[model samples]
Target: MKNLKKKLGLALAVTLSTVTFATAYSTTAEPTTAATSENVNENTIRNDEPTSDRINQFKDIAMYYYWHGGDIQQAEKDIFKGITLKGKYDVVENAFKEATLLDPYDLDLKLSLASTQIIQKKTPEALQTYKQILNLDPNHFNANLLYGVYSKVNGDNSSYKSSISNLKQIDAKKTNEYLQKLETTETILDENLNTSAPADLPQKDHAIVILGYALAEDGSMREPLIERLKAGLAIAKQYPNSKIIVTGGVPKQGITEADAMSNWLISQGIEKDRIILENKSTDTVENGLFSTAILDKEGIKDVTLVTSASHMRRALTVFKEASDFYNKMNGNNIDRNFTNVVYLDYPSLEEAHKVSKDEILVIYRDLIRTSGIWQYPGLQR
Candidate 1:
């Protein structure tokens, strides 16, 4: 739990840095209008001023906890008294429920609420929410896509079949080609299930890429990152000829994740030339987008990815798609083989088993973003 808190807190801090919403809203400021995905001229806001402010406040708080990864200690801090991490989904649900009551036509808010419902594994509630969104606009991209994915995952074929057209309408970014190659959680888990590294991988023309996690405010390596570095060190020792690439761009105080990772690797006796710093990416998706181009330049053929098991599926998919994206632009099929060295972020094997499927399903949201649709459908990448 000590390690978990450090990891989650750093993530929250980074997310907080990017927050654009008003943390405090005027209690007397009335809800003059509500905007949907299209932001048409419809103005359906009917709530009192106080209620409008309350739901926005609740939405902000829910976002905080969502980024907090449900860490109990952080949830208790600030003015968030009486709210433990366990109540995170409840808070999220309440926020959406109130906001929807204020303006039933706000498709964006409804989508966010449906997303939270999915995270909480409230299938009935989530389906209802998605249905509500679809009822409002049958062509809504996110709602149709999510509803399709969730239905297929739960073995409901009819809804999934009907939603493909709407899902395919929004953003493909020419990435529709790689959709066939995307590995589901069911396909890859059995082979990469171990948290330990394999020793027999080839060294030449291969690279060991370490993904970065958020760092402490003072630029110190948190326990989880050090653990990943230690694992990278072991891989470096085992495959002495393999190049090491550390990718992260988010800085704290002054040091970037790549700088910190490279320094740590060199301190552990790894050669300086063997370690490459990719300090331009801000997130896992960007890590894929930026690092693959560098790999192509260095003539690296096969790549092994080192990330927490919690992040492995999404990271793999993103990097694979990144490689595909670059190849599509250059018209050269660069060989990008991704092998995984999974770090067990769960407290126990039992818990990992229990949550793995849900983790797999939840990654579709990020997958959609990777395919060029931003969180809100109106914003395209």
Candidate 2:
């Protein structure tokens, strides 16, 4: 009877050991589902059931959110998180590769990978990635755009020229599409410009007007600039406005356009109270954004955003996008809100010399404006 009890006890020990081992193995080596296509049924994605499908759903959600809100960094982070949370790097890499394979026609993924490689300073890899994109799509607009940007960043002027050349080769209809976008932008701007703000247009009590970018140190006002500023100041002067934020930092550290403009405007005998000097914004976007902040803090809301007539569309867009005018009025609960704005233009005489190249410039300018996050947000027009 004692021997029988000893054998039973040994069998219990064996059973417990097997159970523990199984538990440990199950915990450590969990079956990981890859965030890949074949492993995930596309239909299951909408239901969010399978692990891979859930990951895909997360990716789609993140992408949609980012696209609408203009939040790319967040999108990238979310995508990386969704893939990596599966606890597999190879799986993530394979997913990215599978994405490229599945949509062999799409260069965005390839371009994204190339941009990542460029950021990591992996030039050879970036080059290979771009080459692969070019192999798949010889005339991909984004590929050319990024190639030009990378070339310019790396001082590869030869490559830049090649990329620019390739961009020029886009068919007329596609080029027209870009132009139509600009035309639509201009239509909105013109509609806004030609109309008077509501009877309760916010009055700028002590606002500043910053004369943005223009040719440096040119003594005389260019015709376009003159016409634009004249129209702008005429409308603004009707509002009993107190100050002008004349701002422009030197693109090159010589006599800045802002100083020249201030001197010229003051020479016209505009009161010193009317001009608040801000001779320190190098680019148009900075001129608008930084000036908006400064003026907003000073309790000024009505602004005449003076720039070339040609630049009014972009300037207005930037102000709309970046300025605190909207938030400040709503935050302070100030019923007497003022977001009044105007545009000016001053195309240089030197433009006459380049009249022959206007067609080319028009195309190249639009391409450059649309291809990247330019220094000025709305200046594409």
* Cα-based RMSD of candidate 2: 20.0
**TM-score of every model versus the real structure:** 0.67, 0.39
lDDT of each: 0.67, 0.46
C-alpha positional error of residue 156 in candidate 1 after TM-score superposition, expressed in Å: 3.1
Per-residue accuracy of model 2 over 1-381 as CA lDDT, tens digit each: 222212111222222333332222111112223333445432222232344433333323322222222223322332333433322222223334544654556565565445435433555666677778777787877666556645554557788777767767965555544445444444434434332223443454645354555653344445554544454455445655556667776633356666666666666666656766677675555666667666666776555555554554455545543343435444754332233344422244233123222222233333343334341122211
Worst 10 residues of 1 by lDDT: 1-10
- Model 2's TM-score against the true structure: 0.39
All-Cα superposition RMSD per candidate: 9.2, 20.0
List residue ranges in candidate 2 displaced over 4 A. 1-190, 195-210, 216-221, 232-237, 251-253, 324-381
Determine the C-alpha RMSD for candidate 1 after optimal superposition of all C-alphas. Answer: 9.2
lDDT digits (tens) for residues 113-176 of candidate 1:
7777776787678888889989989877667777877786666878877776555666563224
